[model samples]
Target: MNNQHETPEQKRERLRQEELKKNPIGTLKDGFNGNGNLADLVGSLGWKGTGILIVVLIVGYVFYKLFF
Candidate 1:
């Protein structure tokens, strides 16, 4: 595809992919530092939804432990 035909979002994503390949360790660091959508979703969920998610995770872990 030609750069001239690329949309703005497509250009940004292509650049991001190139940068990711050049600095994967930086990507991992950013992910661990919660510079991603998971953190945003958790924050947007508010305390009640966050608590419910934690409870569900705990239950899933217990089930995994029991079965595996």
Candidate 2:
């Protein structure tokens, strides 16, 4: 709990755990910024979520191209 007392490895692990608790939007931003692995993010979403996301993206792209 005390950063000053933590060894480098402990500090790194604490930070890693904190990063893992980020919300989906934060994770998405981190992925876009290249600070996080997108594969990990997609893996967290699982197949159902991944499928829905893809469908939504395709529909949005089609709608955008059709309207604007």
Q: Pick the candidate with the highest lDDT.
A: 2
Give the alpha carbon lDDT tens digit for every residue of 1-68 in model 1: 89999999999988876766677566655755778555444544557877998999999999999999
* lDDT of predicted model 1: 0.73
Question: Which model scores highest in TM-score?
Answer: 1
Clashes of 1: 0
lDDT of 2 at 51: 94
**CA lDDT of 46 in candidate 2?**
56
Predicted candidate 2 versus true structure: per-residue lDDT over 1-68, tens digit per residue: 77789999998877665665666567666766788786656754658878998999999999999999
Candidate 1 Cα deviation (angstroms), residue 56: 16
Per-model CA lDDT versus the true structure: 0.73, 0.74
Per-residue lDDT of 5 in model 1: 94
